[model samples]
Target: MLIAETSEGKRVNLSQLSREEITGLKKKKHYCPGCKSEIIVKNGTVIMPHFAHKKNSQCFFFSENESEEHLVGKKLIAANCEKYGIDYELEAFLPELQQRPDVLINRKIAVEFQCSPLSIARFKERTINYQAFGYQVLWILGTKLQWKDSCSSMQRQFVYLSKNIGFYVWELDISKKEIRNNYFLVSSIWKKFYQTQLFSLEKESVIDILQFPLKNHEEVSYEIASKVACEKRIHCWNQQLNQKSKSSLQLQEFFYQEGLNLRELPVEIMLPSFQSVLLKEQELIWRFQIYQRIQRDKKMSYQSLYRMLKQNFDKNYPLISDCQLIKYHLSLYLCFLLQNKLIIEKEGYYYPTNKKFTLKKTSQEFLGIPLKYGMINK
Candidate 1:
């Protein structure tokens, strides 16, 4: 709420004014641009100078308790837009959508500086609403919402996919006065990892940095779990099964009904693929399902396999706009099988080789054969 409209309909930006100027302006009346409700100016030494709605005023656009971090971050983005001479409207309210973004760039890009917790339903609704009106919404996380070792379900909803950067999220740091592009993000069973690219608000143009991935044609490479690491992860899953954990017990029961042993899953079950993030089920579970289908059918078409995997995919990821990721991951897994001579494809049908599934004494023996673990080419 940095910008407020005067009685004469002229917009006033408190961020651009000095303390004395703001103090003088407190004498006049101002209103919120969104709800057109009367707002009071707060010139406090603790927090940044901004407009606040009167007590008991129920404004749909302005929150009663907007955090200090959110206000600062919003003003920082507005300053960056000003620095670049980019045409932007601060806290612009769209009547049709009844949503007020922190900053609207060129009347198309809605920059939302989310410093507080938001429900997934509301987040999805806002995102879908913006997209419906041809507005591209960019969600930038504040310090409070940034991910550490691994992302929570809510944090995962902020991740966006791209060819050059793979999966990415944006973060704003007020202290650093910089925006971070955490890209090529991948997750293991235990943790998540990614590389970061920082853009200084003082030196970089926000528009150019945001468009870099869209314009760049080169692909990015990320390391997957090593062979030993993959084996250890499977060994951990076996340990959970031995402990009779509820989830593990459920999976084991399902496998037992299908005449399969959870402890002796094949090496192919744990291979890493970028699209693994799309599913909440373990890679071993879904991969074994694929193997079982191939075994029973003897041969299957790509469409059929895709439909089968779709049943298990975790479709809760709302930010990942691409609907064909399941197809992409399935194709990658099939290619790996083809490369290893474990499966042969001819006339659009995949035929499994006569590779026998055997019992293994140790986890090390599960991945005895050397295999690739990361991204696969189609």
Candidate 2:
């Protein structure tokens, strides 16, 4: 259907209507989106339009550049695909594909580009539908929509995934261009696919995987360090070497090293400083580490990885609340890491880099600000 094309450069669509129906509606009310008022008809055409308020009429919402907000994301995704040299296309707001997706990339993949709401049900439903078609789906949640008045305005969260319905959620703060969190909704089911070794990664995958945990500020608590080592399946030699006193500064120093590729020690051996061995948790971690390697190697099965993740979470973190809720915090932490460039996703894997990571670098550049002096100082 032909959506509204306004003189003010606004394009609104009633995707449900046909071209004929759109013409019919145009006859009844020459709606001025700016004023939410009906326009008067002169000889055979609409007259000079001015925004007018109708009694008891709710004010028309003049949302800022829906096209820009929606399409910028698609453009970024497109660029990312292009940088990786992948194929894609934008659907715009064409009625034929309204229910389809905002952008159709690779024909086998669909994208719903939205910048509002944390819709749990909607996301779950869409993931299922797109996945059924074996299409990889991505939801670019607009974390940029915050109120100007509220200084406490929170950034929106973004979620991206492939279709298999495996409750695994990895949060990426694209504002910072980092992988924020890596979590499983149904860890048990995730564990199952994981155990089956269902993920393939390219050389770049190693970078994304290893760099993920380093994105966050260096918090080398046993748990954090363990998760980092477990996620990357690579040991931090500096952390291991500085075992006498595990300080955040020490961990930071370890990351500052020039060119160090740490190896994965078997689950049995505890590197010098690690006090507690992740025994029971080792299986889940082992699967995850292997999963990372698979993503890095590009020779793993996604189905197998999903099964392992699902089975592990179900058998272990069975509480729906804990599995879903508490896990988000951990994931968010990972996202912070990615935002800072400490972690990157080059191919299929997430890894750390020798380069320092900072979200301020990218977002500020996008906003045309070298750096907000006061904010940076603060």
Candidate 3:
């Protein structure tokens, strides 16, 4: 029905009213601000029917006044919705009715652009309105147009209400950007540095690189390794004894530090199940020597690896082990490196597989592999 302004007041014009508007009013017939019955428009006249329920009737009212921030936030959300090609509508605001969210998207989306904190009561009211309307709301935390501020804090979280637990809201960190960046980094690194196109395995690394590029692949790997080493800085080698002699004490210490010896070091470092594990002290001296020799000869055999580790450790620390034990340890050490995928194995021999190591295949694809530390299962 059409609403007309007359000397008496606003009146309804049934003849001029379209079928759609009538249906709309009918759908809203049960809605009343006070404990009143359905108000129906009929035959160029408006009639207010009586109702029994007084204070218990459900009703909603609307006006058109909103806070300045609310207006600005709604405009921003509208802009974003337009950019993302989303459908939305701005509901009318009423006086002192604890404003509904800034914008409602696609009838099912609620966006609360929260720049300033609100009381628990106000926040709950706005959230409840969206929830009641069956809208999935996004409470945008942080200030407006502050990209760097948003990126700076690593602990921003999202909260939403649930139907099962009345008024109960759950919170979780934002993961979309982080996950996206990681994937991109892995993909780029795989195509560029490693020359491989296997984007699947390079998931986290790819994402990390995309989010924060630290340089080429070799530089990145060395960076992680160096950081891991420097944090602990555990001196595994003794420098005093071999200082005056031609002893290969530095090489022995490197092996010991890296656990590249006859006996394989146990991976777990449990201390009452509470303390963190100590960092793996790699045999830098021995590893460097092996690395150099492989680069120089263009290949490394079991004989060379054994001679290097055994001679250095035995000569410098003679009472460390016997000949038989030393041989077994060297074999086991090489096997460990191969198992961890730190070194490449080809034709009964091992070689470093990092960016620094030269490979037979010149056209090999290098991809960024994500490195994760601590527990694997959990």
Candidate 4:
């Protein structure tokens, strides 16, 4: 929405011009860069001056309604690039793909500012198009990102396009011009997200982000990440307990009927995985499902039981995750069960040790355990 097509077919960025110039340019006719429909300049005092299509224009960007925040965000990045003397362009148009990036640098890197919720499919399509044109795409999400504050089940989802390619959520405090870079390194093994606090670019002369070494950055151990995830999940449940989310209320009632308390879930059930984050069912539900199944079956035929669970999960939690997280968690859960002597395996089958046993530790107590998975340099 920031870029408009002039009568000469050249892209005009109103943000670069002075208020007097923009106010004067509003008198002339303009057109939407994306739709090529007649456009008008919105020279508002509060929002940055940008072009908007005429009434009822069928432009996709019109429906999106470019936010003031989006306007200011891209300007900030452009300013930073200029300050550092990096060669850049604003909304560089690609004639072949008919795509315009928010900021293009050195005719190679195209930066897309995602201020609005974009479809995963569209996001991929844009990236693919950029790659096909030999341009490296860097996705920077606008600061609209929000995760549920309470439920552990409502864990934050960090979309990593690959080990090297991932989404960047830029927390730009416009007033202070501070950018908090919260980078995530996903565990391909567990499919769990691990966040790394990268160095600030507040004073950098050259942007090394071009190197994109996210895969090499290790910030937290699997143990601590799981603990934090568990805390968030519990917080969500506690919130639901107060607000009465039907599902949480029902889960609590089920636990109560089973002679159990929601808060005091056994330590063995706090399973964590990166890929399994898509699952809407709380970790408690799935973990308890396994526990009850093992208790009832006396001994579990690991292969058959795993296959059955996998089939159900394929339906409940799609194969959307990049890694085999569900499978890893199942195997890891079995390891935990064996380690605690909660279950014993004989001839490739697992059997419960005792009919009934008092809990030695709770999920809360297990938080103290040091994370031990992968090459945990952190």
The candidate that achieves the highest TM-score relative to the unseen native structure: 1
Summed backbone clashes in each candidate are: 0, 61, 21, 11
Cα lDDT tens digits, model 2, 185-212, are 2111113111111212222231234233
Task: Find the 10 residues in a row with the least total lDDT in model 3.
Answer: 270-279
Clashing pairs in 1: none
Candidate 1 residue-pair clash tally = 0
Candidate 3's C-alpha runs over 4 A off are 1-70, 79-86, 91-99, 118-134, 142-155, 159-378
Each prediction's whole-model lDDT (CA): 0.75, 0.36, 0.35, 0.59
Model 3: per-residue Cα lDDT at residue 194: 17
Question: Candidate 4: RMSD over Cα atoms?
Answer: 7.5
**What stretches of model 1 exceed 4 Å from their correct place?**
215-227, 238-250, 253-257, 273-275, 282-285, 311-314, 356-378
- Pick the winner on lDDT between candidates 1 and 2: 1
> Better model by TM-score, 2 or 3?
2
Question: Model 2 — TM-score against the truth?
Answer: 0.29
Per-prediction TM-score to the true structure, in the order listed: 0.85, 0.29, 0.26, 0.59
TM-score of 4: 0.59
